[model samples]
Target: MGIVINQSIKNTVITYIGFAIGAVNSLYMYPHFLGEDFYGITTYILSSANVLFPLMAFGIHNTLIKFFSEYKTEKEKKQFLGFVLLLPLLIILPIFAISILGYDSIASFLSRKNAIVYDYVWQIPIIALCMGYFEIFYAWVKVHMQSVYGNFLKEIGLRILISIFLLSVYFQIITVEQFITATMFAYLISMLLMLFYANKVKPISFRFKIPNNAKAILVYSSFIILSGSVANMLLDIDKTMLNQYIEIKNLSYYSVAIFIATVIAVPSRSMHQITYPITAKLMIENKYDELNDLYKKSSITLQIVGGLVLVGILVNINQVYHLLPKNYSGGILVVFLIGISKYFDLILGNNNAIIFNSKYYRAILFLGLLLAFFAITLNMIFIPKYGINGAAIATLISITLYSIAKLLFVVLKMKLYPFTVNNIYALLIGLLCFFGFYYWEFPFHPIINIILKSILITLLYVFLSFKANLSEDINSVIIKTLKIIRMN
Candidate 1:
């Protein structure tokens, strides 16, 4: 818990930095400089790459985390790590070959409606390979119980580099075409840096020998790849499907709304970077009691933070969008729906870590396959009808259902529940804040109105959260914030 607390706080701060930069890019720079259509095209390429990443990595990233603890001898560990490191190439190389071979068919189909996408479609696999290796190295570090640097690289460093490329585009130092090329270059650079750090953290000894039980390891990695595809598809499929169903330009509008919504999930992402390996270790040791405690604690702690973020996004959404370009405001409903689904996702804390590490992980493959089909079906049906709003609705329904299914599986099979009185309190407090702040606004500049509203919401919400003692972790954070304020 101490490690989780310390690293999660650092990761949270860093994630916030990334989110701040992303907000500026999403809200202002991308829309203002790139224009809505190119922004959509850029987002489309990224989403395709992300959706393809789990495949290219062969799910070895998660396999590394889950199996690294099981090996006893350093020799065995090296063999396992070596196997994991090399295994993804089996998947990546074939995909690269196919992508090159089939580029014309792929581009023609994808760009039938949005011709702008055809020119950039080739970059998707290149970036996916880069991003895939990045996750593999990130998991490499996490298994060694050193996640802060990896988190910085994942959450902040990539975005910072992308900001520079974006600035280059903004100043005409690079063409938009070069900007896209540079974005891929940036990912490759980051992955190489992480590769260096991961090697430093735990140098993998090259063993020409494969790990014992290599068959089982490969089998598990395959299942994880399938399951990882499900989760990634639910996330990345929206923009891709939007390009398929509507004009690519609508994706830019959807991207802004989705970015605002994603900020609500930052705490879960931050904490999971550290907690995942911890959860893996606990499960390996059969420490059910401590694991259960962590499950409940993390659920409530994240609920508290995520709930507040949800409220803040919802309460100030209108004013925030008012500050954006007029075309962008069309995603107001998109933000709300996606934001709620993401908050629901946060409250299921450690559910993913638990399932992915447990033996029941394979069972998720079937459910994920069904849900993947469900997600795509819903998007196909709805996006054409409702545009980006339809995509949000499809996402919300699928994500909510998927989260509920995962929560039920953990509760039923493992007999571990993440909910408690405190989780309920946090949810209610968030709801209370939402209603209280929704109608209340300062009659001033959009930025001023959002600031004042956020401050008031923070004051009342924090006051109540402290009074109710919704989370001891959050209370500790509050105490530190207070002392720092006094010192300043």
Candidate 2:
């Protein structure tokens, strides 16, 4: 429990640092230096690459985490790592070849009427392959219980590189096309750094000895690819599908709004990365009581933190968008819908990690895949009529249904629930803060309005949270931080 809490805190810190860098790049530099269309192009390419990488990697990364603990000997662990590291090439190489061979057809299918998606399309596979192996190496390090450095490289290191690219754009050192091209190179460098760090953590021997559980690993990876694909569809399909029905520029605007909304999910993402393997180990050891306790605490802690972020964003969304170009403000609806969806996901806490680690993971994943398909269908139907707002509506509806389904499964099948009296108090306080700020008008500048609203909301939530004990983990950290400050 102590280790989990400590690692979660470390990862959360790293995620925030990354988020700070990302916010600057997204909210300031990108909007200031690049047009909305170019900004959208940048987001679209990256999102597309992310969606493709999981398929290209064939879920070998997840396979590493799930099976590496089964190896009892050092030699066996190294061999397993080597196998998974090389396994991605078997999938990536052929996919890259096919994409190259069918480049024209693929481009025609994916590009908007006047858009030249092909000119920049080659970078997609290159970036995806680079990202795919990075995950493989990162997971290899994670199974060794060396997650902090890997988390730094993943969450912080990648963003630092992106920040550099944004700075280059701001200085007119790179054209928009050149900056987009440079993205693939940045990912490649990050992946290489991850490999170096993985080697430093545990030197990879190129041994090809097959593990006894190799077959099981293969089966798990196969199933996880389906799961990964579905998750990707749920997350990225709106942006991708919007390109088909709407103008590329509009897709770009929607992407920016979604980016803002996604910041709400950062806490959940950071905690999940640290807790996944731990959850798997607990389930393997038949520690149901510990698992349930961890689930409840994680839910409460993440909800309070995530809810705070959501409130902060919603309260000052107008001010934040006012800083961007006027054209980008059309995405207000997108922000609301996606924000709610992300908040719901955060509220569900470790439902995903629990399900993924459970014995019934495949069935849970299948149900999720079905829900994701429903989301895609909704996007297809709504995006043409409502544009970005329609995509948001689809996302909110799909994720809401998905969350409800997962919660019911946990309750009926596993008899697990992640709610308590504190959660209700947290929700009520969050609502009060949001509504209080929502209707108020201050005679301050936009920037001051944002700062003032954030401060007020923070004080309100913190006061209420301490009174209700909504988050003991964060409360303890705050106490320790205050003591340090006073001593200083």
Candidate 3:
């Protein structure tokens, strides 16, 4: 628990720093320097890669984490790592060949609604391949509980590189096409760095021998592929489908709003980096009491922290859009819908870790597939009529339903729930702060307004939450932080 808090706080700080850089990239640099059309192209290409990377990785990244702890002997662990490391190539090579063989048809189809996508369509598979392996190596570190350095690389290093690339474009040192090419190189570099660091963490001695549990590993990896694909599809399918239905520039607007809303996910993302392998270990040890305790604490803590971010975003959303170009302002509704959906997911705590590492993951995978289908259908129906807002609505509905399903599955199967009285108090605090401050504004610059409003909101929300004792874990941290401040 101490490590979880220590690392989660560090990861949260790192992730928010990344998000801060991303906000500049998404809101300012990309749109202003690259132009909306090219920004949309970049967003679409990355989203498409996200949707494809799962298949290319063959789910080995997740497989590594789930099975790494189960191996007791060093030799067994080496065998498992060796097998999973090579597994993705089996899928990656075929996908590369297919991309080459089917290039024209694939390009033509993707470029049907927007021809700008045609020339750059090939970058998708390359980036996806890079992203796939990056995750594989990232998991290699996570099983060793060395998540902070990986988190820093993922959360800060990549974005800083992108920021530099965007600045290069702004300075006319690189053309838009060059900027796109550099983006691909960025992912490749990230993967290589992670691989190098992973080896440093635990020197890899590839056994080149199949583990005794090869069949189980293969089966789990196969299920994980669908689960991973479904997860990615739900996230990026709307953006991909939007490319098929709307002008490319509209995606730029949607991307801005989505980025703003995604800031709310920082806490969940940070916490999951450490909690995931821990959850796997606890499940393997059959420590239900500790697992359930973790379940509740993770839920309340994330809800409280994530709730503040959500309130801050919603209250300041208009000001946020104010700083953006006028063309990007159409996604106000998108932010609200997506933010709410993200909040629902945040409150679920480590539900994903619990389920993904459990025996009942197969059932959740089926449900995920159904939800993916529903998301796509909803996007197809809604995007043509409602545009970007439609995509947000589809995402909100799909995600909320998916979160509810996961919560139910965890409770019914594992007899564990993640809510307490603190949950309701946290919700009220978020709502009260949002409604109370959203309509209030400062007669100053949008940036200044944002800063002032955020400070007031944070002080009020934190003070109230602390007074209410919404989470013992959080209150203890507050106490310690205060003590440190007083001592200083």
Candidate 4:
């Protein structure tokens, strides 16, 4: 818990900084500098790459995290690491070959509706490969219980680099085309840096011999690739489907709303960085009590923290949109819909780690595939009719259903539940803050209004949450901060 708190706080700060930079790029720079069309193009390409990377990595990143603790000897660990490192190439190389052999057909199909996508079709795989390898190295560090640097590179470094590229576009130092290329290069650079750090953390011995448990490893990896693909699809498929059904600029608008909503999930993302490996270790050791403790603590802690973020965003959503261009304002509903789903996801806590590391993973994988199909079907039925709003509807439905299913599976199968009385308290507090502050806007500029309102929301929310003792971990931190301030 100490390590989790230490690293999660650092990672949370880093993730928020990244999101701040991303907000500027998505809300201001890209829309204002590159125009909506190219911004849409950039968003579509990145989304497509995100959906593809999980497949290219062949799920080895997650496989490494799940199995790394099982090996006893350093030799055995090296053998496993070496196997994990090269295994993705088996899928990546073939995909690259197919991409080369079938570029025309692939590009033509992808660009059937938006011809601009054809020119960037090649960038998707390139960027996906970079993304795939980066995750592999990130998992490498996580297994060693050193996630902060990787989190920095992932959450802060990449966004900073991309911000530079966006600035290049703004000053006319680079054309939008060049900026797209720079975006690809940015991912490549981040991947290489992670690879360097991973090696420094644990110098690679490159023992390529297959471990004795090759069959189990392969089985797990197979399920994980499907699960990871389904999860990524659920996330990025909206933007991808939007490219096919609606004008590309709508994706830019939807992306802005999505980005604003994504900030609510930062705590989950940050905590998961450390909790995942810890959960893996606990499960591998068969420490059910500690595992359940972690499960509940993680849930309430995230619910308290993420619930505040959700309320803040919802209460000030209008001011957020007001700062954006008129065309981008259409995604206000999109933000609300996606924001709720993300908050639901955050409350699930370490549910994903529990299921994925458990033997019952195959069931969840099958459920995820069904949900992925459900998501795609929903998009097909809705996107054409509702446009960006339709995509948000599809995403909201798919994600909410998927989240509920996963939660039920863990509760019923593992007989472990993440909810407790604290969750109920947190929910009530969140609801109160939302309704209390939502209609009351300060008479000032949008930025000033948002700042004042957010401050008020944070003060009231934190004060009540602290008094109620909703989370021991959070209350402990608050007490420590107060003591330090008093001393200073």
For model 3, the local distance difference test gives 0.93
In candidate 4, where is summed lDDT lowest over 10 consecutive residues? 202-211
- In model 1, residue pairs whose N, Cα or C atoms come closer than 3 Å (at least 3 residues apart or on different chains), thus clashing, are none
- Report the error of model 2 at residue 408, Å: 1.9
- State the lDDT at 372 in candidate 3: 96
Residue 294 lDDT, candidate 3, scale 0-100:
98
Worst 10 residues of 1 by lDDT: 204-213
Q: 1-488, model 2: which lDDT tens digit per residue?
A: 57777888788889888888888887777777777777777777887888888887889877877776677899888888777766777778798889989998888788855375658777888888888888888887777777888788878888888888888987889887788888788899999999899899889888777777778778788778778877888888888777778777886688779879988988888887767788777877788898888888889988899989999999889888888878889998889899998988888877877786677778878898889889989998898788889989998999889888888888789988888888898888889889988777577899999888889889888888887777778788778888999999
lDDT of 3 by residue, 177-250 (tens): 89999999999999999999999998776667888889998999999999999989988999999999999999
For all candidates, what are the clash counts? Answer: 0, 0, 0, 0
**Considering TM-score, which of the candidate structures 2 and 3 is the better prediction for this target?**
3
Give lDDT: candidate 4, residue 150: 94
Task: For candidate 2, give the lDDT.
Answer: 0.83
Alpha-carbon shift of residue 178 in model 3 (angstroms): 1.1
Please list the Cα RMSD from the true structure of every candidate, rounded to 1 decimal place.
Answer: 1.2, 1.6, 0.8, 0.8
Stretches of candidate 3 off by over 4 Å are none
